[model samples]
Target: MRRTLLALLLALPLAAQAAAPSALKAEDVPSLLKPPAHGVRVLALWSLDCAYCESNLQALLKLQRAHPREIELIAVATDSVAQQDALAQRLHAAGVDALPARAYAEDTPDRINYLLDPDWGGELPRTLIIRADGKRSGISGQLTPDKLATIAP
Candidate 1:
């Protein structure tokens, strides 16, 4: 029983690591947006402080649920590394903590923002849609249901 208990304790950290969201870097943006063999990649950039981010997240979640297989939603938080715990909590509250996500891991997020999109201006509630063919469309501000439908469709 002691041996079994030790093994379980060793596995606990691994399990927690597997469940935690990953830290995103500026260099990681390209790979994250790479189109899958099938379906479009939807990248949503938000922050817990953004007033409209929750609504945008809800809309994205709805879109994801509608086309579970055809659309892949990835959330990026434009928050500092120090806010990681709170970021995770906010994502949980928004019902997207389970989605593949990342928080800014750099002290200068503008560099990461530029890597994400040269014209983005680091705006909150930004969404990017990458088609299977590699074409990308980006929009800043909360995504409307109509816009979400058009992208997912």
Candidate 2:
């Protein structure tokens, strides 16, 4: 019984980690963009294979730390379902597994990309800043401190 209990304890964390990222669909983008009433939101889109995604995530983490109360940050992974474990590892390494996150559920990513932004062209490391009043702006590529300030400020 003790060994069984120990196994269960060890498995609990794995289960939680496995469940961390929700399956994101095209229909969910609009609601995800809407922050709580009078609250600012930041949405980060990344892919495991993107060269600049890690740095972009670090910038978002810094922004979140600076404005914990004012900004709500969400991360979305555009990787295939087969890369879920790798995606989780990346999120854990970046210390953002605790934040709200979504992973693409479909194999064809263009559908999700179009739902996110028709003009996006499926770029990696896309960052979107939505203000309390529902205004939004986005940039693709690694974010600079100057640009982060504009988003979180």
Candidate 3:
């Protein structure tokens, strides 16, 4: 029983990490930009190395929690599939593991970034807001409450 319990404990973490974010190749970018059938879609583009990304992600998740019915938040990590483990750890630490998330799986991250926004310039912590009416806005850098209001409001 002791050996069995130890094995179960060891396997639990691996099982949880196995559900890490799905791959987000260049082709998947367009579908993500499409406006949701209802409510707003906030596509948060981030990378593990970005200094401000964690805070920005937390803020976005908070906004989503406040207006769950009005907002649909999707987090896409700009890191390649090789960084999947770190990305998953960060998202889980931020308490956002439940949100729809993806990790860059393309050969180059620029392809995904360009598809996300032509003017993005491969910046970290970028956010693309899409409204139900099909209007879209892309914001880079840390997102403040004022910025969050633009989509949540």
Candidate 4:
């Protein structure tokens, strides 16, 4: 009975993780995740408050003008709920939809550090590009429109 219960407990989180969401928190950044309809894997991770992040966001917004449904843009914010609310209002005022970005919770020190960084202890303004089949191209600090497009699967 004990072993079975333990096994079931272990399996619970796997079930939750496998629900396969369009967005999942990666440490500090909320990742825009979607399986390629054509078997291509692609993902982007980013934070707010970084100049490079801002440029990246602009490029992404521009890209969305043409391909909003093609790529999933999950802009993860590390700010408090109040701060994120204000930011969301600003985005709404600019006519940017909330679907592109969402607030990521840093619920624990380890998760927060991983989301931010351990090497540089950086926060905000990060992007992770993952390929189809779960192969990753690596994460970037700042990205341009061209650069962002270059990682498309």
Q: Return the TM-score for each candidate structure.
A: 0.84, 0.85, 0.88, 0.55
Give the clashing residue pairs of candidate 4, or none: 27-115, 28-115, 41-131, 41-132, 75-101
lDDT tens digits by residue: candidate 3, 1-153: 999999999998986676488998878888988988888999988888899998988899899999999899989988887777788888888877778889989887777788888878888789999888898889889988788788784
Winning model by lDDT: 3
Candidate 2 on 73-151: residue-level lDDT in tens? 8889987756677787888887777778788888778888887777787888999778878677889988887887788
lDDT per residue (tens digit) for residues 1-153 in model 1: 999999999997675454345788877888987877778888888987899988887888888888999998888888875676677778877777677778888888998888887878887889988889888889788777678777884
The residue-level lDDT of candidate 1 at 45 comes to 89
How accurate locally is residue 3 in candidate 2, as Cα lDDT from 0 to 100? 100
The segments of candidate 3 whose C-alpha lies over 4 angstroms from its true place after superposition are 1-11
Better of 3 and 4 by lDDT: 3
Kindly report which residue stretches of model 4 are placed more than 4 angstroms away from their true locations once superposed. Answer: 1-48, 93-95, 107-123
**Number of the predicted model whose TM-score against the real structure is largest:** 3
Residue 21 error, candidate 1, Å: 3.0
- Candidate 2 local distance difference test against the native: 0.81
What local lDDT score does residue 121 receive in model 3, on the 0 to 100 scale?
83
Sliding window of 10 residues with minimal summed lDDT for model 4: 16-25
Residue lDDT tens for model 4, 5-107: 9999999766433322222345324333334454333333344355565566666666655565555555555554335545565444444434345554434
Clash number for each model: 0, 0, 0, 5
Root mean square deviation (Cα) for candidate 4: 12.5
Which TM-score value belongs to model 1?
0.84
